[model samples]
Target: MGGPDVLATWSTGEHTGAALDGKSLTFPTYRKGTGPGVIVIHEIPGLTPQVVAFAEEVVAAGFTVVLPHLFGTPGKGLSPASLATAFRQVCVRREFTKLATGTTSPVAGWLRSLARDLHDELGGPGVGALGMCFTGGFALAMMVEDTTVAPVLCQPSVPFAVTPGRSRDLGLSPADLDRVKERAAGGCQVLGLQFAKDPMTGRRFDTLERELGEAFLRVDFPGMKHGTVTIDRQQEGVDRVLGFFAEKLH
Candidate 1:
C-alpha cells in the first residue's frame, strides 16, 4: 500500500456494500472474511489502505469485517492535506459531533442500526466493533446496544477535546454512558489502545478505567503516534484487537 498522500484506486468488488439509514444516511461499507461480524469504522481520513490493511487482518483472523467510509474519500491515503480536509469536513457535517462533550455523533445511531442488521445476518452470539481515531469512541457507544459484544477503541479521539470536560468525556450522553457502564460491569470486556503521549486521547482512557473498572482493558503504547493500530501500524495492538474479538465473538 502507498502512503496517505498517494491516491489509491478505489474498488467495489465482492466486499462492497452500503447501510441505508432512514433514506438519509447511506453509509458506504466494505466487507471481507467469513465467520463472526466485525464492524471496523475508519478514521478521519476515511478508509485508506492502512485502514483496509487493518481490516484485512481482522478478516484473516477468521471474522467478517465491514469498513465504513465516514469522512474522507475511500482508498485515499492519509497525509497532512488529507487529514486537514477530512477534519474540516467532519467539523461542518451535521452527522458528526465535532466539538462537543458527552454527546454521541448522530451517525452512531445509524452505525448501531447497521450492527444489529449485520448480527442478524451473521447469526452469532454477537458482533465485534473496532473504531479508530475520530470514530474510536463509537464502539463504546455501540456497547449500549446488545449486539456489540466486542468493542475495541483504538485512540478514539473525538469531540476535538476542545474543552476540559470533553477531554475526559466518552462522547456519550449521560444515559448512554450509564448503559455502557452497566454492560461493562456485566462482564462485557471493552478493549482500548492508545499511545501514552497522544494528547488527542486526553484523559478518556482514565475515564474508561473509572467507569468500566477492570472491564476496560487498556493497552498503551510508548510514543506520540496517533493511530496506534493503523497508519502507525502496531502489530501488538492488532493482535490484541483480533484476540479480543476471537475471545468475545467466537
Candidate 2:
C-alpha cells in the first residue's frame, strides 16, 4: 500500500464518519469553500490512503467531498493483501459464478441512501457520485433516483450479470438503465475512466460508452493498471475529475 506522495495535507480538512448499511462508514471529508457536493465511493480494497488522497484533491477544487467507507470503519478497512489474494483466486477459480452473480447485491441501495444524506447535508438539490472498480456502477444506480445526481462511474464491472432478479441488486435494472438513458438524452453526463491494461474495466468501457452516448465520457490511461486513478492523483484523469466537478457541481 506504500506509494508516492499523491496528496498535500492542505488539500483537505479531516476524516469523518457516518452511519450507512449498518456500518460506521468512515469518510475523508473536505468542506472549505462550498460549491457542489461530491461523494467518493472507494474501490474493493476499501478506503485506503490513495483513495483519501484523491478525495482531498477533489476538495482542493472547491467542492464538498465525502469519501464513504462502504466497507466499514477506519482500521477495519479492507486489507489490500487479502483483496489481492482474493482477486488472484477469482482469476483461477473457474467456477466462481458467485462472484459474477453477486453483482445484483444490495450494496447499491446503501450508496444511493448515502448520496441522499450528503445532498441534505450540503443543502443542494442533489449531489455527484464517483464510484470505482467494484462500486463503479453504483454511481449510475444512484442516478436512478434522480437525474440531478450526476455520476462518474470509473471502471465499472459486472455488465454481463444483468438479469431480472439480480438487476436491481447489481445496479442495472431495465427501468434504471432506461432512466439513465433518458437523463443522458436530457443532458446529464456520466463519466468513466480506466487504465488501458486493466482487463476488468477496459473491456466494457467502450461498450458502455457507446450505449451511454454523449452522457458517457470515457478516458483511458495507457500502460496504467487497475486502481491507478486514485493511486496517482496528480495524473491528468484525476485533474480532469476535479475540474469536471468544479464546473458541473458549482
Candidate 3:
C-alpha cells in the first residue's frame, strides 16, 4: 500500500553548544491533536519523509509526537558511507556503547528529557516511545526509568551480535536487559514489531522474546517488508501496532 500524504508541518529548532556536540540537530514536526507524549526515533537513514509522516499519525491519535533529528538538519540525506560516518561520530563523541548498556548516552538522555518535557507540557504522567531500525533497541533502554517511558520496538536492530563480543554493541545492555526483565516480572509490558522476512530485525525478535518472556509481545507481519508500517496509514501491521500501543499506553 502507499504511504499517507503529509498532513501538516511545524518548525523545530536546532540545538547549539556542547549539548548537541557542536552539530545542528533540527527536524520538522507534524502534529494533530494533543494529549500523551510519544517520541519517534528514526532509522539509520535519518528522519525520512515516511518517518515524519508516522509521527503525524501518532499526533492524529491524540498524542503529542516528537521526532528528534539525531543526525542533523533536513534536506541533505545521508548516503551509506556518510551514514556510517555519522554513526561513528555519534559513537565517538556520545559514547553510545555506554548508553546501550543502561547508562544514558548523550542522545538517549536528550530523548528522555524531551519525553519528560513533552509529558509535562501535554499534561500526562507518562509517555510512549517508538524506535526503528538502528534505533529499535533504544526504546527499550528508555524504559529503564519507567516513570516516563512506555516503549514500542519496531524492527529493532543491533541485538543479535554478528560476531564474538558483538553483543556489547547492542543498544540495550546486559544490565538494561536485567532491568527490563525485572520490570516485566513486575507487570510492565514491552512490545515489538517485525516483518517475518526482515532478516535484520527477525533475529532480534527471537532473542528478545526468549529473554523477556511474558513481558515481550511480538507481532510478525508474514509478508510485510522493512519500513512498510508508516504513521496513520492503514495496513494490517500498522493497525496491529496502533492497537498494541492503545492497549498498553492509552
CA lDDT, every prediction? 0.83, 0.61, 0.62
lDDT at 42 for candidate 2?
Answer: 76
Superposed on all Cα atoms, model 2 deviates from the true structure by an RMSD in Å of 6.4
Which residue runs does candidate 3 get wrong by more than 4 Å?
Answer: 1-8, 14-32, 72-95, 98-106, 159-161, 164-170, 228-234
In model 2, the worst 10-residue window by lDDT is: 94-103
Residue pairs that clash (backbone atoms under 3 angstroms), model 2: 104-169, 104-170
The pairs that clash in candidate 1 are: 4-77, 4-78
lDDT of 3: 0.62
Cα displacement (angstroms), candidate 1, residue 229, comes to 1.2
Model with the higher lDDT, candidate 1 or 2: 1
Candidate 3 structure quality by residue, lDDT tens digits, 161-231: 45433343446546666877788788778777777776665466666777778778887777546664643
Q: Per-residue lDDT for 1-250 in model 1, tens only?
A: 4553322322232222222223356666666779999999988788888887787778788998877667787777778888898988988877788778868777778788878888999998899998988899998888988999999999988867777687898999888999998898899999999999898998899999998999999999999888887778888988899899999989
Question: Candidate 1: minimum summed lDDT over ten consecutive residues — where?
Answer: 13-22
Clashes of each: 2, 2, 2
Clashes of 3: 2
What TM-score, computed on C-alpha atoms, does each candidate reach?
A: 0.91, 0.72, 0.75
